[model samples]
Target: MRTQLSIPVTALAVIALAACGAESGPGSGSGGGTVQPDVPVAGVHWTVDSLTVDGTRTEAPDGAHVEITDKGRARGNYGCNHFGADVSVEGDTVTVRPAEMTEMACGEKVQNFEDALRAALTGRLKAELTDGRLILTTEKGDSIALTSQQPAPLVGTKWVVNGLVLGDTAASLPAGAQDKAYLTFGKDGSVRGSLGCNRFTGTAEISEDSIAFGRLASTRKLCDGPEMDVERKLVKVLEGTATYELNHRSLTLTGPDGEGIAAVAAEIPGEK
Candidate 1:
């Protein structure tokens, strides 16, 4: 199985914390017959819930998550930058080697949290799974809490464009247009959203792995240079059929020539 762990920190201040061992409370562990000690931990989207170190606990950020695969590979984001590591699972114990992390600069608070998380995840840890939750406890009693999450559906999801894909690389959107471009696909073969500066409505023919866009009508609006640039790129990709790859919460739409946009599922009100 190929596994990955993506960690992320939030705006929450990274205050000093402690090490509290994870106790298998009621309904946890394999003590009860209902608890399966050998549950498969691979290929599950484990959303980080919190981190308890020494004795203090901190809630995880929205995008904090981890996943492991059967291929001995672990990859994930640390709230800001992505990272990967080698891991081994034996019986109920999971051993995580020191991770190779990306050096993207983050805010002081997030950086501090990442440092602390990196330290806690290295070396051998006891793995416990029960009721769709997984806890990995380090030898020093530090533990990370995570819950399983179902993959987001493609339709009816608010996919906000986060980056532009060129060839095999993905680049961030212009600063001014960072969170402006978004799209929502409807069940009625309709698509609508802002192109960073203009609101566009169009017909989308959805196939098993591709989207054939029909005539897209957009409101005529003039915007700043950055916004216009974003709008142009988005329109180009949505002009024709594009292959799409959906990985958990992330989506990549690539046009025929290999240029496209990378989007992520946005949280919707009243939906989990």
Candidate 2:
């Protein structure tokens, strides 16, 4: 049995804010439950939901996908192979496992996924949504944390601002932000953006799973806009989500489907 611990209220708040897309860009959610790990449920579908172990950013398992039906029916492609899983959710408590997998081995990422799937099928979780995205948990605390395989950064090289990654979960926004408004991160401490409405600047730091973005002050006067407001939400929401991607030069971010968010990424200025 994986260790079970009370998740801090602050963390819950942060997770909620991150999933719900609030003014403060925080995360939110709650609850704890006793479970029989592999218990089966009748209606709700429990799916992959996320693929953080492979350093899921906006662009992850670039060629893979996960989809679940409303009745808890699910089917999708994991980057290297096909997979199927069964899930049961007791309010916030979730139990999931991949009932099917391709015989072909896919290295550590796939293997880790196999392990997490097994745990999720039996381990207990505290699940919810904050900042407009869904979060699933197993083992309550971080003891069962999966290692993220973040890609290399082409920073200072001008890759577009794709999206953020929090463990295997991703928060992406293209619908709310301008289709033309864009971004770039440099080797220096500066992070700049076009805002799709106006130019704005902020400081940034690239970490293993999180990107610290803030002091998001903008140009002198605000652009006459709803787009700006939309951009604001997108930026703030992105701050809490960790960042990741497939190709930085491509400036693309992708969100896992059903998570209620889209993946985001940027094209490298000079690259094709």
| Backbone clashes under 3 angstroms, per model | 27, 49
Candidate 2 clash figure, as a count: 49
> Candidate 1 — what's its lDDT?
0.69
Alpha-carbon TM-score of each model against the true structure: 0.69, 0.33
Q: How would you encode candidate 2's per-residue C-alpha lDDT over 148-168 as one tens digit per residue?
A: 122235464443333333333
* Segments in model 2 whose C-alpha atoms lie over 4 Å from true places: 1-154, 157-177, 224-226, 238-266, 269-272
Instruction: Name the best candidate (by lDDT).
Output: 1
Per-residue alpha-carbon lDDT of candidate 1 for residues 123-238, written as tens digits (9 for 90 to 100):
66776656766677889999888777777788888999877888866566666777799999989999999999999999999998999999999999999788999899899999
- Candidate 1: where is the Cα deviation over 4 Å? 1-40, 49-64, 76-84, 89-93, 98-119, 139-143, 174-176, 267-271
Give Cα distance to truth, residue 218, candidate 1, Å. 1.9
lDDT of every model, 2 decimals = 0.69, 0.41
Give lDDT: candidate 1, residue 218: 97
